[model samples]
Target: MAKSFASQGDLTEKKITFDEVGPDLWAFTAEGDPNSGVIIGDDSVMVVEAQATPRLAEKVIERVRSVTDKPISHVVLTHYHAVRVLGASAYGADQIIMSDAARGMVAERGQEDWDSEFQRFPRLFEGYESIPGLTWPTTTFTDRMTVYLGKRRVDIMHLGRAHTAGDAVVHVPDGGVMFTGDIVEDHSACYCGDGYFGDWGTTLDAIAAYDVDAIAPGRGGALIGRDAVTRAIASTRDFVDSTYAPAARVAARGGSLKEAWDAVRAECDPKFRDYAIYEHCLPFNVARAYDEARGIAHPRIWTAARDLEMWDALQG
Candidate 1:
């Protein structure tokens, strides 16, 4: 039997939490769902990673209002995934910031991703009609951009490609906090369909070089200490390497995608089965690993139709 695409089969309402990990900084997390970070500067506020839809973002907004009444001055999009970028319009930000590569990703496959992700996860896109359209960043930076709110400074850096070609990290040196958007997850499946497995490890290494006190990952609970942060980053690296290594080797040896996926499943499932979204990510992760093994540098656009076709073939 074919399984449901992405997270559509998951219907349980998650318990949401807003935890202040540092001075004037909070993390909005819904169990293992996409997490957003809030930075309240002296004069304004910056939100990291928009939820999935406009209505969904309202929940995050309500939380933000409870803490500070400052207008949401800047919205930082860590990457261009539909689940992360579509709800940006609801923030009413003066400038939506992203890496130049992310802006290019929006231009290339944002619409297709919109259609693809909506079909895969209906619960995330609760008010699908409320989305004004594709979220576009008014400000684009290549390497890094500094955002100042009074004396507070939030540095957004394009830490090489990991989850996507445009993956960016939000670092607050003064706050000793870093918002790693999907680059590092604790007990959550790293969605590798659009990932660069090889480059991802190096990116994680660079992020680990920093003396981060806490981390607001794209998914999962906020890492509150240096040990917890170190563990989460290491786990993310392990998952990425364990999934890609076998698939790449199999593909090089004239093996098929199914064979590679089976190898990856046998290796990773026992260790990661209890992780969030592990079941949903397996098929896509293996597929991309196989493609990269075959020397496909870029990920193919995943559409709603293609999602089902891939599910029927892989899950059956």
Candidate 2:
């Protein structure tokens, strides 16, 4: 199956859904927009994935207020994407958490990412100046760390690299619900601009082994039942495979970047034609896949200028 995109005419703002995925576990989804996961324990709250900006995060805070007054003590970052982490300060959490790798990615390329993303999607960055600065984590863990929101145990693990080198998943063992950052996304398009396509499959398999009952993907609607969860995983896997495989094959045949992009688009556009942000993501996705397929392990940093250059080179 191909990925879906947001309708160009679908200007309706997404409504937030605060659904109980399990006991003390909730998912705050905005139609097909970015999502935030909540782990409410006996005393406090842990939020997974802050929204894009402080102004945007306030909306999430409003929903969180509907449930508990327990202070949001922790904001966990699943990765170091500007759209995902730049809103950290809005949470007002005493401690911001992230994986060591994620923090490094932020320190290394956070500013460029901020400039690049803001330029790419201006609508998502409404109230852009309200952002204090690049969101930085106060506490970072190497592989795994356990936090107690009062009594509830939330295990934040960097299972493997998928979306980025710093991708992490918030696993609630007892609840059987996992808050997978960009490591997994429902019918939405996967933004693989800074991704490792070959390793992402293995990372996703590790996520599946957890036997999660429900999942809050980085983007898209929440997957409530086992069937829906399975579909989300499979759909994301298929997207990654369909996207990267053709690019890799074309590059292996000594094709130009434009040729590789065209081959992947021919294979993917027909299927994922309807996916949200398919048009927006395709150029960046193709660029990263092309680099990876050509044996460039680390994706080159993408600036605003670089973004346009790549888009122009590949899109036509």
Candidate 3:
């Protein structure tokens, strides 16, 4: 029988944008792909999220070069997903930062996640060989850490458990811009393969309370203005709810994984069918939702073998 998988090449690289959010704060966004934020200080710079590989990161570096010559001295990884953290080496930052919880997640399942993600989406991992190794944090803090880029203050906070147990957001108070990693998405789908669905909603609420004027979400274009920010947050929440809630209910009703998958498809496909990565994310989302509804607190680590098994079980 033919393999029941879509080609990863279907996703193509698009142009990236650099938009000013505030004084010395900018959002580096691409069309519905992973985004990176730049916080420029008087002397140095801080990168919010790294792309999937060094080659990919250079694209952002080129953009950063066009506006400022400030050296990128730090990289803040919002979470421990392979696609997000693996490109840290390209930044050549003096310090790599993450939440304590995020560091622990890397120590626990980082390797497995690396293998699983590469297998799931080969297109994103274009220069797979360039990955130095699993990206590890040089500095980690619990709750929050305040860093000074000359006179500017950048607050890095864990906020709460959402996308992962250690999701961090970079809040630029002076700039009134927030770099929300996977916590907020504009038009892209949320990949809840390793998420806390219930806690994720509350986490978003906390982020909204920041009264941000602009937002650089994990994926999609940069959100401008208060209304755009609110709309992006709401859309992200709706995507999570519509994707996981029906599956959770079906699982509670004693339905099998396949059954729950069907229910989720029926409920969410109409709305999210055309969104980027929707097809790539559904199986993993359902697997996670099923586990959560069954009272599983921590998300299971996904290995390449398990990915295939889940896909086969649900898609067959």
What is candidate 2's local distance difference test score? Answer: 0.86
Steric collisions counted per model: 0, 8, 0
For residues 142-239, write the lDDT of model 1, one tens digit per residue.
99989898899999999799999999999998989999999999899999999998799999989999979999998999999999999999999999
Q: After superposition, how far is residue 266 of candidate 3 from its true place, in Å?
A: 1.1
How high is the lDDT of residue 8 in model 1? Answer: 82
User: What ranking emerges by TM-score with the best candidate at the front?
Assistant: 1, 3, 2
What are the runs in model 1 whose C-alpha is more than 4 Å off?
none
- Report every candidate's CA lDDT: 0.91, 0.86, 0.89
Tens-place lDDT digits, model 3, residues 234-291: 9999998887889889887899999999999998899988887788788888999899
RMSD after CA superposition, every candidate: 1.0, 3.3, 1.2
For model 2 the TM-score comes to: 0.95
The residue pairs found clashing in candidate 2 are 3-275, 4-274, 4-275, 4-276, 5-274, 5-275, 5-276, 6-276
Q: For candidate 1, what is the TM-score?
A: 0.98
Q: Which should have the higher TM-score, number 1 or number 2?
A: 1
User: Clash pairs of candidate 3?
Assistant: none
